[model samples]
Target: MSSDRRDFVLTAGKLLVLTAPAAAYLEAVETGKAEEPAYKMAEHYWGMIVDVDKCIGCGNCVRACKTENDVPVEPYFFRTWVERYHVAEGAEHPDVDSPDGGYSGFPEKYAAGDGAKSFFVPKLCNQCAHSPCTQVCPVGATFESPDGAVLVDKSYCLGCRYCVQACPYGCRFIDPRTKTVDKCNLCYHRITKGLTTACCESCPTGARQLVDLKDPKDPVHDFLRDHKIQVLKPQLATGAKVYYNGLDGSVR
Candidate 1:
């Protein structure tokens, strides 16, 4: 095998070994041999590649996510949201807005002769390998899955807000209705059932594409191996799973 392929297999093997105990425990529970609760084994590593160049800021994704997740109407608990970054050439200040929590049906405004262009960036939990939210959760409410997805056990959350503060991206938030900390799980429910996430499915421009990195034949895995990709806040060493292709320099 090629060196790259060998390295990938080695890494995958290590991850499998690390998750063996959890898998066994979950199997026992599923068979009624244990009383403890555990997440079901994920056979694939979920990944998303967003092409910022194709994003149109249509807000369809935001609306779909809210409706699918049954998010509260007031103080919206957005599983995904968009950020508008306006940068002017040689200007000291730039305007930022997420009108109507990013569900506003309107075009973005741009200044005339602006030195730099403005763009809308969609934001969500990165589901990092070294997730700050999971590490700081005193009650083990937040956790990282073997497939690199970050999740929360809402029942175990103590509402301490430690995870919220620990997240540098400001993705986690306390749900007003549940009073528990919440963030994106990458639509775990839909994914496990072999369905696309509501947000991804609703995207009109097809800017969001979900793939399983575990399968070498998958387009996303091939793309990541062959092309350049950028991760959000990579300097923080979070090992984020979500990657952006054709990302703007101002997207950080």
Candidate 2:
């Protein structure tokens, strides 16, 4: 490990001990000692659910995520963005657009009662069980956490865009500042501390929810069982963990 990696591991260990009551989990290759680690990888499995019916095209989630994660305000660096779809009656494909990643909310593109239905679909890293990005990463900088969140170790990242190209959702991007491939991590640092993701916290109508599928009390279980849900690209068999309710056929 490099000096930066060593320092990070040491800092994480210190934070872990100070926040024990939170039951947070964060593991690194090594710091200095072989003593017992604080993280319990098996204790949780993380995921998210987006309710299309609840999203109002308000752009609150997008703005909150950008601010909280320090994602670049530029168009190409979105860790999470909302797409607005306008599906005409009996149309084969919807006119989809996410101008500036919908950071400033969507403008009135189509008039009301214009023979088209409009809705918003938020997009992010799927945290796939069989992620192509993770497979193609040569340095193993991008990895699937034991708790199921796909994360990146910037220190170990080689700044290769393989993971960026591998993602079908267009979620991964090269951070100009770090030159490291970046994507949604479900706010791993916050979630591990028992707090919800910034996006979820900012959603005005509960459009997004950060859930731990492994937790019986997480409510995602019943949400999945109770709702008619679908993954973004189920045909690829990515084992994507992000679920969506009322997903439209027009979304691409």
Candidate 3:
């Protein structure tokens, strides 16, 4: 199954590189003959926004991400996951848990009479502008793309876990099959062709949105300006791009 999956990816990559949409970019990178690169790094800046108030913890996003990306089937391995935060009344901290990486949905842990407010928080790579993961790579295998996406060059990667270690969000992981670090890249193959990431596409509640900060006409500009947003671990100052709305103060 893994071999077949890898073959599919290989075929898809080749087809993508040769297709009309990416032909010029391929020529520029592979042959250095194109007058201009097809996808300019400066033309786009990508990010995501999550409305905590809208998330339902249905597991659609998690399931879609794993299937779309061919992620391994293990509780510990996830490109994107969801955490169920149960904030007890008058408590300083919330109880957080993600069973099976929230792949199969959650059982009711709190009752209506439990006096706890429960919400779901989806988690993934922040794609930070000043990412600590990018800073710690011994090799340039992991890089922040010119278009503001954090991507990995699997061919150049040495299977080191430095990038994984430096990530504060617990986003990166070393793939047992490939022996290489892996994580979400906002579904670059899809996004470059004007498609949304799998998680965003599959979210049932419209809780997630792919945001483009560089486009003046993009709705993301207005959304950011209007909403009171927060990023995880602002104290680390990684310049995280993922924004959260209606985030509970008890969230870690």
Candidate 4:
């Protein structure tokens, strides 16, 4: 192990008791055997591009995320979910719902030619550069990673739920198993290994795509320059990294 890695492990161990999996991960890193141990965090500024128009409400992404991250099966606890927005003609606000966090495909609620325009909006952690969750976390367990994903160290988390309340996007939830605040980290484990997120991988229509903002050759640059993309709740100015194309104004 490098001196820095050893020091980090030692410091982290001192802060809290490491779980078996966490301990094994530390051991792997010390031995230079961890998955993608050599990943250069500094080289990547991670984000995501969500093509709003392409999402078909298939619920494939939600199911894939749950399977990949082991999210709680119960309703209202999700690392990622999809919401269906129905805007009645001439209505100011849209009626939004996510049945089972959209784990199962949405049922047909509105009849054809009902004068309601409905669309599916997939939701996850914004991965904000100025994240309120990190600020509100008293124990420093919730933090933004160097590579731009907001993450939580479960061992250090106090399960206080402060971060959950501070989040503007309602993306966080308390894990039933661990009793800790949890949200999407953009599949940090897979991304560090140069693989796409499970949600992105499962989307048959390619609605979600993992992006590296700092890479000059990355196609995200072209997409951003060519398309008029917007972040959810841009008025809050959270510096959210996730960009949505073809987003409707009525979405919340």
Candidate 5:
């Protein structure tokens, strides 16, 4: 007998001895269908690549993140955001502003030949391997997943705001409704199902890319090998996974 026929016969024979649910199993076996394999966290080491020169300050990433994650619409709450930086020709620090967490596109503030070079920098959770937020969570509510995403357990959170204060990148925020600290998880729900992040999907300029460092075939390896990359707040030694290309020195 063919494999399908053999499977069907074996399943049918067992049906007489098994429970009603076996009927469903038999049908699946006969059709050569099986459940999707569970996602293996160990198989992936997730990260992100942001190309600064390609970011256009359009706020698409911010909008997509809020829409996908149901983050509070208030200006104070954001899973991801963008900042506009103005580096004056002789200024000591770059003038940085992110109005309403860049939910809306930025307005033109500098005129032509203002002697200030302006650019957009998109920001999100660094998914650090050695995240301070995880260390400061006294209740063990916040943690780094095996796949390199930083996640929070709302049920275990004490709402003490320790993690929020510990985050050097200003990425963590208290979800007012949940009364717990929340931050980006790199869209864990979508990524586990083989989908890219909402921010990456929405970026028109292809500035953002989701990467799997463990996958030898993933393009992130080639990109990293070829480009000069930097991460936010490297001095803190957070082991941040978000890599930036063409990062300016003036950026904080």
Candidate 6:
């Protein structure tokens, strides 16, 4: 392991000892010590449910993600990205934002009355079960956590663009300032601290849900079992954890 990783491990060990309750410290220590040397391969598979029925394309989630993450104002480094799908009565390949992230308003572009037919679909890192980004990382810089969240070790990343190319969803990108591969970590830092991801918390329509599939009691899991959901690009066989309950077929 690199010196930085060693330091991180040491720091984490100390932090656990200091923060763990007195009654749980010993158990925590044992678990931490006995744990695999590498990052835990997540036991559960996580997925998301996007309720297109509830989404009004308000862009609240997008704005919230930007403000929370301190992401550059440039039209890049998007932790959550939105796409407007303009499906005419019954047509495919409807006009889109031309990859520049520009789109007309709902009522004006799709007609106020017909807005129901044309809707926007926001996309983000799917956090796949069999993630292509994980498979392509030569240094194991990108990995899945025990909670089934995909993340990148920016410190270890070589910036080869392998993960960027491997992602079928086109979610990964290289950070121009850091010169490293960067993408949505699902706000792992915030979630681990008992907080919802910025996108999920900011979503005014409650369309996006960050769920723990391991816990059957989780509302998201129940919703998935209860509703008709769609997985993006399942053909690539990444075992995508993100599921869209009301995704229009044209979104693939």
lDDT winner? 5
For model 2, what is the C-alpha lDDT against the true structure?
Answer: 0.89
TM-score of model 1 relative to the true fold?
0.79
List the candidate numbers ranked by lDDT, top first: 5, 4, 3, 2, 1, 6
TM-scores for candidates 1 onward, in order: 0.79, 0.84, 0.85, 0.86, 0.86, 0.77
Cα displacement (angstroms), candidate 5, residue 124, comes to 0.6
lDDT of 5: 0.93
Candidate 4: residue 28 lDDT (0-100): 87
Residue 251 C-alpha lDDT in model 5? 85
Per-candidate count of clashing residue pairs (backbone under 3 Å):
1, 0, 0, 0, 0, 0
lDDT of 3: 0.90
By summed lDDT, the worst window of 10 consecutive residues in model 4 runs over 31-40
In terms of TM-score, which candidate is stronger, 1 or 6? 1
Instruction: Compose the digit string of candidate 5's lDDT tens values, residues 96-147.
Output: 9999888999988889788889999999999999999999888789999999
Clashing pairs in model 1, backbone N/Cα/C closer than 3 A: 89-115
The local distance difference test score of each candidate is 0.80, 0.89, 0.90, 0.92, 0.93, 0.76
Residues 29-114 of candidate 2 have per-residue lDDT tens digits of 24433355465669999999999999998889889999999999987779899998999999888889998888999998889999
Which runs of model 1 end up more than 4 angstroms from their true locations?
Answer: 1-42, 91-94, 111-115
- As a whole number from 0 to 100, the lDDT of residue 17 in candidate 5 is 75
* Each candidate: RMSD: 12.7, 11.4, 13.6, 9.9, 6.9, 10.9
lDDT of 1 by residue, 1-252 (tens): 699999999999999897989898888878987853343565578878887778888888888878888766553567788877787766566567777658874464775575777777787788788887799888888999887679999998889999989998888889887889888888888887778888899998988877777767778867787768899988999978888887766666
